[model samples]
Target: MTQIQPASFRDAPFREAQFMPVTLDVERRNDGTVILRSRVELGEYEPNLAQAFTKTAERCGAKPALAVRNSDENWEYTSYADLKHSVDAATQWLIDNVPRGGVMVMMISNGLTAATMTFAAYAAGVILCPVSTTFGLTGGDHVRLRHVLAKTRPDVIVLESNPKLAAAVVSCAGDDVAIITTDTQTVNRRAFSLSSVLATTPTSAVVKAIANIDPENTVSYMLTSGSTGLPKIVPQSMAATAACGQQALVAIGRAADWGGVIVDWLPWHHAAGASVLRSTLLQGGTLYVDDGKPLPGLFDQTIRNLREIPIAYFSNVPLGYSMLVEAMEQDPLLRRTFFSKMRLMLYGGAGLQQHVFDRLQEFAVAETGYRIHMTTGYGMTETVTGCMVIHYPTEQVGIGLPTPGLEVKLVPQDARFAVRLRGPNVMRGYLDEPEKNMEVFDEEGFYRTGDLAVFSDANNPEKGLVFAGRQSEEFKLSNGTWVYGGSLRAALLEALDPLVSEVVLCDDDREFLTLLAWPTAHASDQPLGTIVNRLRDFNRTQQGASAIIRRVALLDQPPNVDAQEISDKGTINRRAVIDGRHEIVSRLYAAEPDDGIGIV
Candidate 1:
């Protein structure tokens, strides 16, 4: 077995911080399956999420719990004490209106109001469901939104006072369901304003409702990204949610001690973003709800926000970091302010390119003379967030190990292992879909993640696992050679660095591999010959028919969110894109490639 050596960062200064000690117990079964679990116990955790909020309120009363940018571009903060008051009032309203086990669907973005209602629903023993704003506001038939409404049968829907959202909900939701908004005037339906809900006087019933919350009961219904099919509802129990937070706290250490200020734009509808929100609240840290996204014309806001906030922890997708690296190369102040107090940096949603990772470290060393710890994790919505994370300091990019209270089962599949998770953090099953639930879990009750991984160092299990690709996305060529889409996409992105923002592989049962890519803003101006030369360089280094690309097409159009081509987390659905752009794929495979297509 060839040993994998850790990347050398001898010149980079080491900034010290406490992280969970690495400890693992491995069990290799006769069936060629390996079970890995942390020997460190989960210890004690607060199962009631409301109690976590209440504790933070009591401990950090005057501190800013949440902040959002105003129209003037200045941040407006809501103090913990004020937030607690609003939560209690909203809890009272929930108890008086919705049933104890009823569902409250929130269609709003991350903000003060969203945070207040989230904790209120927790306190009131109501299951809160948050969906992507794009489902309601983006131009489509609202199929995903309609499907969610039909599945959960929510008792109430909370949203901003936008007529578009209100009309969408009114059309899909039942008449019996109540509509709650920030303002009722703009809503065509009879809705109650959030101010009225916050004005309710808390009674003893509010306390009783809090006391009645069952940790084992479903507290939230998180929607899957629907990359493979229609979105499925994953029922998250309070125990699972609390367990995930506790696991993170144990693994990553206390964020409060690490300077607990975060600026994030990840939508709360997804697991990673929701984990950020919950973990911040549990740690008694302040969060700035960023309105800016990683897209063009919007990331400027993120840069502006970062200039003012000296954050300790930062997280974003790889594209965001790429953009940041470009901006920081030109602006020295942005780099200084960003790296000044940052202790840890995290990237997720997709595999981060090695060049992006290296560039970020270079910036960190240049700014602070030390490398900020960067890591990634492996998990899904079914697990409520990441159960396996890279907590240790290493230059190697891989999902480190299972957190406390979690067990990972690795079943061999081809050259990789199919990762299955069994943990307190794992959800019981999908909401109201028994057949689908039965299909997802193994006989021993592990959630089949459908993700593939291999040991980064096969001789050293402690080095943890590196993501190989999605088992579902791997397809065989007509020559019977299997192509791993995920890892290939990562390689393609890295090889074509600063040229293509995203690429989709398109050679399932074809003679040769081809790709559909969206070019970076800078690369868009380059001549077609430039892209062809890069592909030639890439193809020269690659061996075998499954690895080399024969043709490529650079698309001017971005991935359409409405068509399910891209998810809320900015991950492209490979199947969706191939099907949606069938015409383009055919042209790339034509007997004579068009002038627009680049051939190597």
Candidate 2:
């Protein structure tokens, strides 16, 4: 038996390894403002994502690349060679149907078929667009999808076996757009079956076209969550996408002899999922598709799958990890298997509560006699996935240092610094948004992140940056004091653990702040008196209005997904929740507060 040693960033072996090199340029202006830019040396490897996948497949020809549960509830495997072949076949079909520069929008489940089509779109040189399937087929959700369809004007639209999603895409699609689905029973005469197309062989001409694809061209057009407004299309270049995958591979620090395994259910629509997909392919690792999400009804599926497969590494949002912690606490076998082969655990998208972090450490020590390294990074769709990563092992909550091929600049913004980034991994600009794009970057060419951050220590950058809310999310009180929502939310969640699932403060031009709290499952089980006492204790420890949650109304329903109150990535949109639930908020701030409202 051999012991698997984890990779450390400070090790001599790691420091000497030749990955891509990024040159950082710094300039100081007379006005005391500084600018930063990072340029990558591009001669080390192939820039095209499909070409990189092809090379990886050649290296791991017979290795299992994709695994999915079949209709008979058996795990079906697709080898690297099989995956490449399927992608090529799908690419041929896409070439015949969609012209160059055309958009191909997909509303599909996370499975082998969906993964195959995504790569095929890349190989065929069409701009692939992925939208959230969590958007149910009604009201605002439906309207939002229609807006995406209208904005992208996709030449081809692919839907999963889901009838609801198929109906939504069909209704929104233009008459000339080709509608495709995996459901054989689909009644639409014009809608083509994906299975039939995948069975065909690639023509020589189609193969030639695939080889002719520009390595630096835009391969994907990802849609923003539109939590603030309508969704914007971000065009991500092939080089940028590939750079992210390579950076992740370098961070994982697995030796060449080491292969990896993952059981992931993150939606492919988000950059997080794409990063995992690319890294898996780049490393020639096996990916087991889990059809479950972190939500109550679906998380059982994730647990069932994990019971069968042992993963080398895993990543999920804070809510998912919180739920998993509860399950692992009660089930020792689950905990043992979870930490058995795992190298690292990663969480991102929002601030992870400290209690959740502590619980994971507790379970890790109990199961494996050692604490598993858990960390997270920070980035958006604009940066492809992550620019700053915790490449080294640490339990602290900072976003970590900038990865190779990227530069992070902190500029003064209000009381905090705005995090601006420049790198090969960053997107060129949003599609059809020239003016908006112009406003995002400075003369020195750094993209404004709209995020505020403060370094853990001013003198030491190695300590990393702490997230202070988004500039757009902050609001001013009537007394002209500004409130940072992210900091407040993180503090409240940490101090009042197991009581609140989420908190959104409403204090714009108000005398005192009010909060709309979404209670955790544990909190609901407790008596109202007990919950009020917890809030009281938390408030007494705080100093000012921004820190104290004055009045709170526990939400009767979860944050509405359709109304953009909560994103698919498990992040609450504070502005959307406030706007959509104004009536409930008004009640919380009434002259005579409602009986349901609790005051500190």
Say which candidate scores most in TM-score: 1
Per-prediction TM-score to the true structure, in the order listed: 0.95, 0.90
lDDT of each: 0.85, 0.76
Error of 2 at 328 (Å): 1.1
- The list of candidate 1 runs beyond 4 A from truth reads 1-10, 255-259, 478-481, 507-511, 521-526, 540-544
Q: What digit string (tens of lDDT, one per residue) describes model 1 on residues 1-600? A: 121122434366666666788999999999889999999889987899998788888999999989998888788998889999999999999999999999999988888888889999999999999988778887667888899999999999998778887778888888888889877876666689888999999998877887878899999999998877779999999999999888888888553242278898998878888888888877788899988777667789889888788887888888788888778777878888998988888888887777667777777776776888887888888999888889887878888899999999999987789999998999888888999889999999998998999998988899989988887888999999988878888888888887878899996899999989888766867986787788889889888988888889988787877777877667788888899899999999999978988887
Q: List candidate 2 segments past 4 Å from native.
A: 1-43, 184-189, 253-259, 478-480, 540-544
The TM-score that candidate 1 achieves is 0.95
In candidate 1, clashing pairs total 0
> How close to the true structure is residue 320 of candidate 2, measured as C-alpha lDDT?
87
Error of 1 at 577 (Å): 2.8
lDDT of 2 by residue, 385-430 (tens): 8777665545568877676667777787666778888888888889
